[model samples]
Target: MNKKILISLATSAVLISSIYADTTSLGEITVTTATKTEKSIDGVTASVVVVTQEEIEKTGASTLDKILEKIPSINAQYARFPHPSSKSKASISLRGVGANGTLILIDGKRLSGETESPYEMTRITASMIERIEIVKGSMSTLYGSDAIGGVINIITKKIDKNETTIDIKYGSNGDGEAKNKNVNFITRAKVGTFKYKIYGNINDTTPYSISKSYSQVATNPSTGSAITTDAQHGVTGVSNVTYRDESTTKTIGTRFENDFSDNLKVGIDVNYFKENREGEYIGTAKYINSGTPILVKNTPVSSEDKNSRLDVSLDLEYFITEKLSLDTNIYRSYYKKRNYTNPINFTGPTNTKFSANVTIDGIESNLKYELNDLNFITSGIEYRKEKRESSAINPDPSSSEFITKVVKYKALFIQDEIVLNDTLNATIGARYDNISNADNKTTFQAGLVQKLGENTSLRANYAQGYRAPDIAELYVVSPSYKDGKRFGAEVIYGPKTTAYDLKPEESQTFELSLSNKYNDLSSQLTLFNTTVKDKIELVSYNDGTAAKYYTSENLDEVVIKGIEASFSYIFNDSFDLSLDATYLKTKDKSTGNELMYTPNISASIGANYQITKEFSSNLNFRYIGKQFTNSTNTTKANNYNLVDLGARYNINKHLQFYAGIDNIFDKKIEEELGTNVGRYFYTGIRVSF
Candidate 1:
């Protein structure tokens, strides 16, 4: 469909909805991520999106990534090609800010491990989440590093009555490739004054090769011709070149809360996750020897990766007076990963083993004071320490190993929310962070919301954000290699290094949004602009050798601007509709080129209908516009559309059955882009007690 047509249709829907708008209230929706304090959605000044549990169930999504991709301004990449030997991880870029710029939190606490990796997006099951709150634009004033893009806070369920649920699902592609099975169980109960919830999940998926859909070919460097036989260019056909690895994941967690007295309450949370992956690849390599190019057949390589994470946190809330309260949290998290690969005839390493361990400990306390009816103040102090250790073992004793790195930081922040009048509200906040290894930094944010009428409001915000370099980006010492680098032969480069004087990336963002809620119609339109300085990027350079190696560097500047619009309307009790779309433009100022993998347009349309009290069905359509695959904008991935159909049937109060088909059209994109995995069908049953 044409972009103009889509935009016109969306605009028409909003106008139509307003014409038929009634007086029914949509009810008050409260969110805490915007201000770190509970406030109605209309009162919050930030651009926020809330996904409720009912909405989650309607999608029939098992993983968090599957559900988040439908939201506007969020681009999610899952199970893509050209991955490392380790298991595939899902990542998201908010408004083209890059994956590493976003911060993810569970219950308002950061997770341990590499901040760049959004593994939780895939590991956390949808059944365990009560709701998810997404706040767009720079949020460094509330959260610390990695908030340059935005913040995603996942809130888990807290049951008020005894309940238990069991869910089982099975899925497979049209050709029976990539078979998957999942099982989940959750139980919540109360013992005297203590309430607790326990949950567990297990998922397994088989590997599938894309060789049937795409083939790999080698080119002779001297003749500049395609080579099909080993005798022609000493190259053999590749096996499993484009394949998805086999993986198994398991998770278990528990949450406990108690009110010891009327003035005090305490809570504890613990969670553990583990994943294992297996993969194999066979190919050939060519190299130069004695000033002559030589092609060689390489031995096949197999790899195994094991990863685990553990997290524990304690929370306390105390009431000191009628208008004063205190909240404190202490938490600890640990992540470990091990990777092993079989010996190979080519490349740099044989019988390689790599391992990494990351640990984080933190404590925070906040005091909330209701200064008066018009103004509220919140102040907090935080202390956090991070440690990382990584090592690699190869048959060659000369290989370099990664060194351990530790960083500690202390922070102080305060915010004030003032209700100037019944129709206007203002918020101002600032944070000062002192780091042990880097320069101290301070950030600020200001926002205002003004009611234009009884059903319309306008909001504007400005914020500063920054991201400090992590251990892997600043201290990594590992060998790097590239395929088909020199005359079609793999090049084994020396260990990659980073400069000790690397500076943090900083950004300034501005956003404005107009929102209206009238009767059964709700709509919002937002515009955002962000300018970043000293953007960290990996660049390749030749160190006077034939081989090319990569190092971390800071670019001069980058600019990203985007517009987002969303609308929803309830026609009646039996049917509803929703539409959302985003248009983005991003550029690297130094290179004068658009950023890679940032799409120009994306949109989704959804409809839900109820045939009966026990039967309901939904249809969703998603469209992703063309995107460039490289920074130079030489290669492009064409636009694609996906259609999903889902239905649910409730047999009784204790049993429910649901089924869904995703990617109904079975669209596929270029291999340089991500794989679409074609059409998939899944069914599941939920039992409650």
Candidate 2:
């Protein structure tokens, strides 16, 4: 049978079961995207996934990447532990789109240091989050930029006076561990309402070893020397490298919320983070050839990075009438960051990027009115201004570069939700943004939801989104050196040529979804299509001789379409099972070819059984399909499957014992990169109090 026929049969079976079991409870939790105020997710005509605190703990995820890896349509990658550039940096690719297209928000506010790279720079601690909400498809009508792929909003924990907790974890295979302690204290009867939360975390890792394998190097016809690096395996005349890294990050924050009256609220928040990381490189022997051992070298270098941000915000909510309300908020953020590296040449160059500071101020207001029992509308306007100063020094004075950037943006948006009947609804929204670099743009969205039964629903959405280049991409000035040679600074230019020359990236997305629930089963399936114009791509230029220079440019067009499905079934009282699958096919329409690094199929299966009231066991199987590294698809990656098994034994109410094995099959598989391979297994335990 065809795959489409199979999907239709499965969907029909689930919908039939759900229609018969119509007594299933409905979700009451509200969302903020579809409307200015809180509204039920069931009423929103879009695909959404919510990961709550309980779900986060139940999944036993150690980091943000681990949890995202489980999502059916989301993809992520990390270079290594304690990466030099960004500790919290992880690429968040949705469907077949790149990471740069996804928009991320923290506590309803944009990230302080959002840069315009194909990757994101988010640093929120996973343990400190109260919930994570994922909105799939285009959202330009809600957010101005980076909403071409999707939106992910992380809500932090609210201050609480009742409880405090501490968590510590340890693992194997040079996999470091982390200790997190958080306490929330709140006071309501004092001179002013005070709510404060403090968090401290420590992570440490041992050295990891990578064996070398001998291979033929691509020869350079001109020099008669090797053009590529060669590694030897299980032999002499080679360099055996072992890597060790450790990082400690501490964050302290407090929020004071004052209720001046029933219609006004004032809030002040301050947050600071101090991050220190160190890495060690060890070589058994640096040999040029047999009996030609040069020497054995070992070096340890460290860097300390710091970031601080203070936010002062005020909000006022007034009831204009019984059916109308006015909401307004104003905020200012002061940000600073610094990175200090030891005097060592790693990656063949003495690299450093230090002293980046920015100050931002923004204000927003919304007017909401209820026309009737089944209709409502919301209109809002927002304005923001940011000033940034940065400098990069090559330690040689003449090779240094400096940058100063100022940007201002303004937007006006309106949304309307109409409930045609008890079983039908439609929503329409539009937004217009005026950017300093560019004139202006308008994006729009429309969605419809139909109720098939009490426990089953169908939704479809279409949206148009626009994204402008960020400050980093528009005005960055840096220096680069030639291959392992400390030749002075090589000129590096920003993306902008004449300030307003580049066109804004625009996209259109269409999505259809079905949700169903039965007594012991719940499932959701989605199909999405996205087309982007003026897509940005990096282009590399070589002088036809020795070195290559890289810059960014706009592409003609691209289109991506994918399907995602998830199912969960509860069997009896002690067992449960879940299956999730995703299939994506992306192509560059201008070339009529598929895009690279976007797999065709990926899936996972999970099962859990309760051995006893206090003891439970979990098993998971994960599969990743093959992908390519280059647009031309000259190179290919091998697919691999991995298994994870774990158990939890509760000692008492105050303690628990848990251990899990990652990469249990010990499969040696190369990722998208042909030369780099990842294969390892680790076991970790977690303690909570």
Candidate 3:
């Protein structure tokens, strides 16, 4: 079916359901990420989405990516086998912007490691989270960099009474391949003035081969057409790659808080995570035949990847006076990764190794003052230092050497909130940042919210955002080699030269939204536009050899604009439904082409039905429109649909059971787009005390 038809059907369903719906308001929910202060959803001018603990449990998702992909205007991509050479990691992007444009936080603090790395999200399990707040649009006025797209803040749970919970789950594909197991536990207790929480989790998955369900498709040189074949050798598109890698992930964390009188409170948090993966693939090898080099296909290659992270933080809250208060956070994070590849019969080295280590330290303080009944002011200062040591570009294989880089930055920001009247509110903010080895930057933002009626409100916002060049883009001196598929050819990437004179990418964003809640129906519509300049892009040159050399360079401008709509209706006490859709258009002015991977249309519909007080079920459907995979727009990934169903049964307050199936129709897309691990079934049990 066409995208228009599907969208129309979804809209009709929402409208039809609203006619007979009867429910109560969701009540006031406060969010802190939008303004760095507690504000109700209706009061925040930005486009925001909040996933509560109840909603999180209903999804039956074990990882962060699964939960985020269902959100409107958010695009998520996953890799079956993550590898350093491939530079492929599971990622989530806001609007049509890339993953690097988004900022992720845990309890308002940035995660440790490469700012662009999405692996950090994978380490966060669903069991420990109490809620998630997603604020869309340019946020650089409050956050200095990497906030052009938006920000996601994860809030952990806090218990007032002593409690302990344990959960276990297992899942596998219908064909009995790619099995997975997960176990997690959380315990919390409260004393007279102190509170603590402890949690741990372990997850493992077994690898499987794609050949079981897919066949190799090679291009016919004579006719320029694609042909499916079963040949094991001399083929361009080998289907012998591992569909999923054998992997194991572990996590442990603890939180402690103390209240010393009504004026002061202190808290400490510590978290640790570790992951390991192993996989094998059939690739190519070079051999000498009759004094000529011959490329042989179907060569066996093995790889191993390992990653670990540690985080420690201290938080302080104090009230200097009744109208003034101060909040502070001090944090340190460490991350490391190591990868090894061994090709059985290759021409060069027998083994290749790559490793990276990152350390970050940061401190931030904020003070809020109520100048008068209608005016409020907030100001903050932040300082951060990051250091990275990596052998990613060390050209030598036998020598264990690495290149180290350090970055330090300081920032100051202030914001004012003004209430013009009972029906209108306004906010303005600005920030200035100074970096050690980069140009200084300053950003500004303004927003206004006006009530149209008792049940409707209108909001408008404007902001400026920027992103600084990372260490590898500015300081790498050596070359790194990787064999990959690009533009339908087996290509090799040589060294990526550094560009010391690269400037920061800058953007301007404008947004307008209308929201309304009437009876049992709630709806919202938003329009947004973003224009970016001095964009940093990797430009490649094909040397006479088979290698493509690259350099980071400032490119021309690009523009992205989109429309988003969402509706929810409660049919009765036992049934509720939601529908959302997004339409996007992006263009690179220099090339007059749409941005790669930016789909024009995407939508979702979800419904929940409570069969009884002890049993509940949910069904969800997702659709993604066709998208281009290359800058030239020659290759495309066709549209696909997904359906998921889950149910929960509560035997008592202390014990519960849940089961679910994902990709019920077994929809599959091109391998280049992402892995579609066919139909999967999972069941789990939870016990609480």
Candidate 4:
């Protein structure tokens, strides 16, 4: 291990742990460290999880998709466009490998990609999100190709010290909500070596309703009759659909940090987002009204959507000698999307998509040393580039249209973090990707962490991952006047060369963890085993007229075994309690069955109370077990439990008041096909200046 003697033994173990004291606490600051420290997430070897901002303000949950549907091993989906127009796709998926192998970032840059999930889709506005780190398994050796189902970054909102705020809401179906203010004003005088920081944020939301139909007509759980269809029709999921296919996120952001002398510091960040949306659906049939057959239905759907995004980030740190240090980063992103559709049983074709754009650029470098006191070392290098474009139009007249394909990607990586002592720690990383369509692969990872006292801790990890093939799954094309040649170029080409032998979907993971803390209490337990190879599925053929022609495959092997747990208790300091659980068992080792929406079990439980010093209250419960919505598993998605309530008041400290109630006891869940849906409450208030 000679990289200049592991940087002189990590600069003599950070000068013998900085000459004795400074336990490095800020909870072991390892978002790649900078002072603050607390580090032990089972001593890190990567398997991160940090959802702080006071746990999203103690889960008053106003969005971030209701705090990621209470974790349950993460799986989120939303829409603005995608699918057969699944009423505007705003998707996010984690465990089932959908959502583009899951990789979404902000604050750490990189965002924009969507042809129905390949993860670089952008439209950020979770009230300028303050925290969310979620790094679950397989990071493709530190992010490459959507990290193959991991990595979620999204940490905005910083103005440490001085602050300002405002939030408001209304709930129960007809629902309406708003987020309009957050201001920070701070100052400190000093000259010579200088110091400065500036922060900013402004966010808004007005469209919130993603389906809730009902204006009358029930009874039809399999022909009980009375069935009017479309679940009755219009604004009736029993309140709480919020805006029918949701949309309306406006955001403005700014950040600046500098300190010219203390080892040098620099930071600059910027962001912008705008979105608008619309949706509708209804159906029922029984022709021959003239002859007296009655029962006619048609409400089709009308749609409109727009999205814009821009982000820029640059950060640098240099300490040069004293032990040696250098860190650099630069990022760029730009995106645009649009959609318009009108269908009233329009029978194929009438859609419009004026433009879609995505661009990204990234750079990273890191080096640190502190050898001694057992051992120390750190290294890094990273690069990424991506581009995408699209255009479309189809107005029928028997149809024929065009505009497709322009995707690209490139990646490189390296990592190491070894400190073997005080109970052991080790980490290794590697990544190499070059994809325009295919060719090139290399991913690796190794981890270990152990410390069995003062509480408890133990960890292990091994990873080897790969994922590639998303340009609508190897270039998809379908435009017809029934083959008069308007479009029909679905190519997979490339066996001799032009890049495309496609096969690049591999995985191997094994994980085990157990962490414990006492005195106020804290707990964690994780177990994972993943094995995948060429696993990508989507097949359906029947393109005669009624349409339905899809293809994408590699499904040869699969296995996902999991168990995750989190527990917290702080019975003092105003009371607290928390619990999170997940159990998964997905298999399809060539048809051993069990693998659809992949939901073996899910759970959540939460509680918090503090009736004094500015009041506080919280309660939560969530569970979503059963799953399967296809793949010969034959449709099945039932298993529901939900309840939420929140309260917070602190009319001083610049004023504060909050309210919440979601789902509560209004369970009507049933996704896909029989949609009964649910979400019955919303309440809000917040102000600070």
Pairs clashing in candidate 3?
A: none
Q: Please tell me which predicted candidate would have the highest TM-score against the true structure.
A: 1
lDDT (0-100) at residue 448 of candidate 4?
Answer: 85
Stretch of 10 with least lDDT, candidate 4: 480-489
| Candidate 4 residue lDDT tens string, 19-49 | 3232222135345321112254556765677
Mark the regions of model 1 whose C-alpha exceeds 4 Å error after superposition.
1-27, 77-83, 212-234, 281-300, 343-353, 392-402, 477-501, 542-545
Local distance difference test, per candidate? Answer: 0.75, 0.60, 0.74, 0.57
TM-score sort, best first: 1, 3, 2, 4
Instruction: Assess candidate 2 and give its lDDT.
Output: 0.60
RMSD of each: 5.0, 6.8, 5.6, 23.9
Per-residue lDDT tens digits for candidate 1, residues 354-389, read: 466888899999999999999899999999998877
Among all windows of 10 consecutive residues in model 1, the one with the lowest summed lDDT is 484-493
**Residue 134 C-alpha lDDT in model 3:** 91
Provide backbone clash counts, one per model: 1, 5, 0, 50
Q: Which candidate gets the maximum lDDT versus the true structure?
A: 1
Distance from true position, residue 228, model 4, in Å?
Answer: 37
Q: Provide the TM-score for each candidate, comma-separated.
A: 0.89, 0.80, 0.88, 0.31
